[model samples]
Target: MDRTQYLQQFVDETGWYNSIVLGLILPEWIWRPLPFPLQSWLRNYIGGSLLYLVSGFLWCFYIYYLKRNAYIPKDSIPSYRAMKLQIIVAMKAMPWYSALPTLSEYMVESGWSKCFSTISEVGWPMYMVYLLTYLVLCEFGIYWMHRELHDIKPLYKHLHATHHIYNKQNTLSPFAGLAFHPLDGILQAIPHVICLFVIPTHFMTHVILLFCEAIWTANIHDCIHGKVWPVMGAGYHTIHHTTYRHNYGHYTIWMDWLFGTLRDPEDNYKKGE
Candidate 1:
């Protein structure tokens, strides 16, 4: 059998739509009684806020309290005051961050974006291709958007600088992940929406990827090196926080390496000594 035939066979065997329906059940239930546009915005805000709070708390509890000795040094643990400030900033930005997804969903519903409802619409082969393309586009867009937030003085001073307050290990934590100015957080996420217009995307997959940002950011801000190659793990992000001159890539270090701004975690350790 050829590639297309093999993909068709695979798709036939996998009931992917069932998983998508399962994921949407809760959101649809919550949205049932709410009005249309308001429901879109309100649901996203509430869901995003809850995800941030729960993920941030669990990660902080596990790493900072449960595995404190294994992950963070005694002096390097972020203070309660710092974590509180991070939470406050993140909560303030949550509503604004939620708007992007609401708007994106509107666009998708109105047939503005090339977002498809099912994998079979494009066939499994093209589904995989589009998915990969969407991710790459998002990665590329985020890298440049993030880099500009630092290179452009006004943008950094007014927007991105809020996140840089946690410039040291002791000041960083899971809570610090979303501690960006409202506009800054939205700006970084605009890429995900942009990709919807650029190519075909599975609606549910796109939504899941957007939500994954919350988990990814929390993980990256934990200040513990996971030592995963190419991934923009906490080790690399820590260098970005301190030096502010390197590793602006999101999701991965490929963009940083390609654009000549990549810095390894060991470099920061050497400089500190």
Candidate 2:
């Protein structure tokens, strides 16, 4: 083979220049079992995780394209300093959270652990119900969470203030909670996390759950303004940040109306619109 052919073969084998933006690297990070006997369990779990990673990578590119087009704004976003602080805070809290005792403790501790445990305990068939159940729960859970943080005096000054710093919601900021107070990321992520433990299922559901989270959330941050109906895609959340105290669900529009938190009920929400 010529030099060019040889070089091409090396690159193909190495996956060099393989790039996925905002893609999850969690699978690569999974803790593999040791001593050569029990590693198969990890391989199975890791395979599912890798599937999530691939979907997440594509979603990242979609968001990046949107960001560049100004469909999502990239300006007035977090500074590196703020981003680093947000990450550091989350890292410090994860270990403390995983080791905590009791479901209630999880609730009081990290939002991530609390939710994940909830879903896990619900067990199989009931776990299948989690997506529907959580979709319902999150509307009130997050809306109220967001509103209370802003309206309650102590919470406003202490927790929710940092996230409100964003001037626009057009860009897909994975670090939306980057500099979040340790308590804040949990508040944001845990609701869904707790739902994870509340129900149980096999690997496929786990994979689906991961993708649902990344894609849906990216769309939430994709709109220029919180447009209602047909554009449910970004409007609700945009409205939340724009006005505060209204429109609080991530996946469904029903809870907002039920709770009177719905900003515009007559608005016809159309998908991919």
Candidate 3:
């Protein structure tokens, strides 16, 4: 099977990873807070779905901040009309993020949640672990998912290539990158859902992380802060766009090195290839 098919099959048999998290062994702090009434409201027709959609779309900003002109056409780039086609594709696919609410829905359907309860009982150190793990799991997932987008040809051509249209990059490009090919966006959420099922993260941490990511990406999409990041520099990410083949890690660049996709632009990778 090809990559997508392979992942599909892997998920089919072992998909229980996500199922187990949301289905049987619920993370009390994370999953148990959703009382049936609130759960139904959030899942069926409330602010939860909107938050998911906004978060997906907001990632575009981060793409821009990493590499300011990454999406715009250089002297050698495409026309504005062409770029819109990519934008259209991304916007068109927005509705697909609705699938994410199902994790919360799972808890509601099972009557396993007890919404709004305080998480004051948990120890301080465990909370630290939760935050760290959540960050690690999230960043790792983004890196691999990004690398997969590059390694797989079919996905690259249909979904990824749309973003690569910019020979000259700029802000507003992250939105371009996120114009996923339907399957891509849904897969992004699956991991987080799984985390909720198995990992015991506090409701506040979960919400805070989600919100922080939103603000971070929104800034990333803005050109005003491309090279000068909010806290640290984005040189690692900037180089990735400059080289196109290296530095695929998001949030942090260390994971790309561990996975072996990190490349140094200074060394002509193909000088000897």
Q: Among these predicted structures, which one has the highest lDDT?
A: 1
For model 3, residues 66-143, the per-residue Cα lDDT tens digits are 443574334323344544565576556545544354455445234343221135545778677766887778777877
RMSD of each: 6.0, 13.2, 11.9
Query: Which 10 successive residues of model 3 have the least lDDT summed?
Result: 224-233
Off by over 4 Å in 1: 1-33, 271-273
Q: Over all chains combined, what TM-score does candidate 1 have? A: 0.88
Output the lDDT of residue 64, model 3: 30
lDDT scores for all predictions?
A: 0.84, 0.46, 0.49
Worst 10 residues of 2 by lDDT: 14-23
Better of 1 and 3 by lDDT: 1
Name the TM-score of candidate 3. 0.57
TM-score top scorer: 1
Q: On TM-score, who's better, 1 or 3?
A: 1
What is residue 242's positional error in candidate 2, in angstroms?
Answer: 1.7
Model 3 RMSD, rounded to 1 decimal: 11.9
lDDT of 1 by residue, 172-217 (tens): 9999889999999999999999998899998889888998999999
